[model samples]
Target: MRRIATAVAAALALGLLLPWAMPATAASAPPAAAAFRQEVPRTILALVDLREEDTIRLSRIHTMVELPLNHLGLSVVYWNVADGLPDLSRYPGLRGVVTWFAGEPFADAAAYIDWVGRAMDRGVRFAVLGQPGVRLERGGRPVPLALANRFFARFGLRDDDGFSDLTYRSKPALADGTIGFERTLSGVLPGYPLFRKTDARVSSHLVMRRADDPASDSHLVVTGPAGGLAAEGYDRYFDAEYNRRQWIVDPFAFFRNAFATDDLPKPDVTTLSGRRIYFSHIDGDGWRNVTEVTPHAAKRVLSADMVRIAAIEPFPDLPVTVAPIVGDLDPTWNGTPQSVEAAKTLFALPQVEPASHTWTHPFQWIFFKDYSRQKEAPFLDRDGTYRPTKSDDHAAETAGEVSDIGRYAVPRAYLQQPFDLDQEIGGALDYFTRLAPAGKRAVLVQWSGDTSPFEDALAAVRKTGGVNMNGGDARFDADFPSITGLPPVGLPVGTERQIYAAGSNENTYTDLWTNRFYGYRNLVNTMRHAGAPIRLKPFNVYYHMYSGQKAASLNALVSVLTAARATELAPVAASIYARIAEGFYTARFEPLEGGRRWRVRDRGALNTLRFDRASATAVDFTRSTGVLGQRHSQGSLYVALDPAVAEPVVALAEIDRADRDPPAPVPYLVEGRWAFSALAGEGTGEGAGFRVAATGYGEGAMVWRVPRPGPWTITAERDGAVLWTGSATADDDGRLALTVPLSGIDPLILRLRPILRPSGGAAG
Candidate 1:
């Protein structure tokens, strides 16, 4: 995210000299020319200090030049000189260097010129980017401006007064009549060939006046015929001096050029291949109205050629898990079950996945606001009197809200919350972990208000289990609906807000009311660029749920989802459950002759059972020696017997008291034999079926059944010695019935022997 602006500039200037000095074996360079024929290599490397300037626009330029520079095979490097230059030796192939010196109070022109000249003399090219009259310095002392001015005048074509005639005009006319401003081009130098055929369009206005003399053309670089360079349009000529202001240039163009040129070796483009990009909604409280609109607008802007849409999910702890479009379920709402149900019915469709946006989107508490004085205070009072509290109290209150939500919503597992510091994150995690069910994992959604906060929150989220951050251009504001249900009364065109409104109507289920839009297309494209999988959750944009009953809003939601799918932004692919099942069957399970074995080779102890089997029980072979018997009070464990072989089985009863040491064993009588059979050919292929049945058991026990049948092996062997072994076979019907004696062992295991045979052969 950080741009090496100064390095880029210097690299561009010095890149011109690389080919001549290349070694004989260099691939891109021709044989070195004769000494005199060899160009002096006046590489004018320049580094632009963007720390105090419009960094966003500067970065755009960086992206732009990256491709073209590589295409041209020009040597170039753009360093963000604020952090100081890197070791020049690393780039031995580069003949010259340019650096953009950055700091407070600006560098003196004289000192900068001397430094550049010295660098040039040592086979390095250098240029400084700053205001025209700015001074350069070394070791905190002023350097003479005369020397720098003199050197720059040659390349810049400036007059004695230190000004160039170069000027820019707008290619596309603005709505207003004003064509362009006659300003001296400062900051980023535009002479580099990298900008010649850039996609980013930049036009210039006529030059107005010269720096040295008002009437003379000495200081002008490229004066327009009608308007000449003048002080009126110049940035430096203003009454209030702008010291750290930077000239807006195409950064994308700059980097595109830097990379294509021979100056700086091209980076490995493949590094970014197959990487996935994930974008979530982070503006919890702010821009609630625009949330829905934001996603739609993002999809619209990014749904162009060369862009692939990645999967987009809502922040965690909501109602859904990676639906095509997800919406944020704000836990802050104090609505009851009926209210929540009503909201879900109206706002959420079956396809949507609802993610939690923390307990009450606690912006105020996280931002350190006083909430105790309010009647509906987040924190509780000592004597039931609601008084205000700070950090810890607020965190506890938030955690309570999470617990309250879990009582009703069984599917809500992801938690999208805001936290400022490490302690806050730790507190939220601790609270959520306790509140979540035993099998669930917690995911954190970071709420970053600005760049700095976003970076900070990102660092914290990475440390957690399932934390992800969102990215887009939507500005955060609290008053707007989470997603624009309907356009406001009077909104201007061409504004970002209006764009959201226009795109918000694309989906038509619930109105784009939540202000949380998926930017479905954009999310996908970024994800594809990042080489991430295309598994996306529905965009879960939420609001008060009962804010409006307008038909427009409902239609907006439907339209958004429908449009997203239509444009391939949201594909109808396999669900997470389906994919997990596929993985198990295709990768995990192995096919055997008669019946397949459901052996778990995964490193994790826990895994979801995909296919439902008929009569087998998954036994933990690592713990017990013999097959576990079924008990009347609790779920039973046992070895399955082939119903074809076993019949008239009696139920074995084992009684154990909670407080008492043990209970006497009672044998239950078999009522009557019920015939359970399977065809010899049925459920018995390479990957086929099996069944088991227990017909003669007593009436009190719950019916025991196996979900599926596969060869299972249970052994209790130590040091190459077998302690005990028992065998149970699943028939073609996939049924196994067996009864274990409950007399001697309080906890006993009867080993189930693994059967080895062809698809339809003998069993062991």
Candidate 2:
């Protein structure tokens, strides 16, 4: 045994080291061996329409195929086989056909049925698309009864007890022991392929029992109940797209049943190759136009298969031109009753900038063919007489028309012409120049198409002001080339042509990639042509709401708006304006500093000069007079004396201490420990009334003291001379206080002589 093992190891080493040295058969082993073995099935094909019906079916398929078990190693081929016959030859190893036959008008039922039958007989599995009860017919003829019965039996549907009940006659048996009448032959056939790995007995296929009847030999398949096709305990299929009006038997269960019965063998796994094929037929339409059924079916297909599905839409190649102002009325007037309400709705959208394309787009002369007869031409005189033909006369008339539209007719931020015709463009400019306010010139001009002359004309318009060229050259095939002979620096490149393509039939919403790419490209192109003076940005996007009524279009708009908001380039001022209009008050202004020189070190320091009606002098400060035994006014306490004064008295002004009352008075001493004095100048005699000047005084002044609160007299005297005297009291702080009268005292001079003081030493 050792010797034999040594020899085998030596042979293996030789084979690895020198493959060519091995026998000829061994040298070609890899390819020859693979060729002899079967390939595992890894992909399947699904054919659907490009309309809403396909969307519904695809949605349903997506749901089923999305399951982990089904998706593990499978792929799907989604094809819009609207042309009837698919190029099956392209898919060399195509295993089976999953088809929705309801929507198409079949030319010959017998021929098509025969073709399908032959395909099935040739070992190609047929997975009928859609749920049970979905009817289909060729040339308006129902599929043969025998063919239908055979298909039904494959799905475990058979009449028992020879009952003639029509309801049960052609019904498929369900897992819940109930039966439902058949609507189409495929209604009784499996809608999905069964893998070899999936159990045949315990699966839904065996669980659904068929009655013993003459029709038992028929071949049919039904999907499981929990599957999207059937609702709980209900034999009917559930239509996800509609308002649940349609129901049919489960197609998944039927397929599993057929596989288990051995009538349809499991696809040869060894022959399967994991290659996916995608087919789509996209045509421009709104969301509502596509039947709700299409998305439903799509969901199911996507769920059942692990494949990439693409839907291509044939969007219209709209010629680039300034978007026409659909309707316009006088500024003082409201919208016309006949105008679409959508215009108003559009206006309400974010940054829905309005522009005039004349009162009705086409030049007035062209629009009202009989402008001269109707006396509507600008050249017509007030009395309806035609003016003599003259160059300046024509200019004046054109100006009047422009004035009517600019001043009275349209309130839009900009104006547009119907076309870039020389007369129209040049006339619009002249008219606007005449009608525009002395300082305000028309800032923008609009025109249509991508003609070379149009590009040149744009340069001329820009030299005078700004111009917006409509997206006329926006063809899928047209490569947007750079424009030349304009300004030394050009406008943003992409802004040149604003491509307005119709939305996809399946998705009515915005196309993020298309819009972003196209919009950005135009802006970049414009910038490249015109340079920075021209503020280039994608200004508008237009779509028809009635196109397909697709919710996707609305959804796309929302998404685009959201994305625009996220973009830094989006106008910030507009957003702020919107917020302000919503009544969301917020102060973004910083306080203005008047350049005054004042160091406010403390809260009390601020009170000295910061005077308004709320100023309280007594509560803000303490006071001291020039001498003792003299009457002083409480108002004098806040007086700002010259710096020449002995102590340069600052008077507490009204001490504001937190522990005291809200406007607490500052303490002062008068009769006992502290004293205040008033002195008459040299000229003034002791016998006459004496006076001392004090500068600051106000209505809020009051002399306050601590201890016992009582009324007291304050005499203003100097050198035996008396100026004035007043009675006051010490309420909370211990000090004699007086209310100084401001009447007749422009520059008050008074003597403060405290006649009495509180018992607890003069308040300090």
Q: What local distance difference test score does each model get?
A: 0.26, 0.27
lDDT of 1 by residue, 23-65 (tens): 3432232223211132212122335456644442233123222
Model 2 ranges with Cα > 4 A deviation: 1-35, 49-72, 79-82, 103-105, 129-136, 147-764
After superposition, which runs of candidate 1 have C-alpha atoms over 4 Å from their true positions? 1-104, 107-146, 150-251, 258-423, 426-444, 448-457, 470-554, 570-764
| Local accuracy of candidate 2 as per-residue lDDT tens digits, 66-149 | 121121222345555445656556654445555543453444444455555555555555555433222235335555555543
Q: What TM-score would each prediction reach against the true structure? A: 0.34, 0.25
The alpha-carbon root-mean-square deviation between model 1 and the true structure, to one decimal in Å, is: 25.3
Shift in Å, residue 129, candidate 1: 6.7
Worst 10 residues of 2 by lDDT: 270-279
RMSD of 2: 36.1
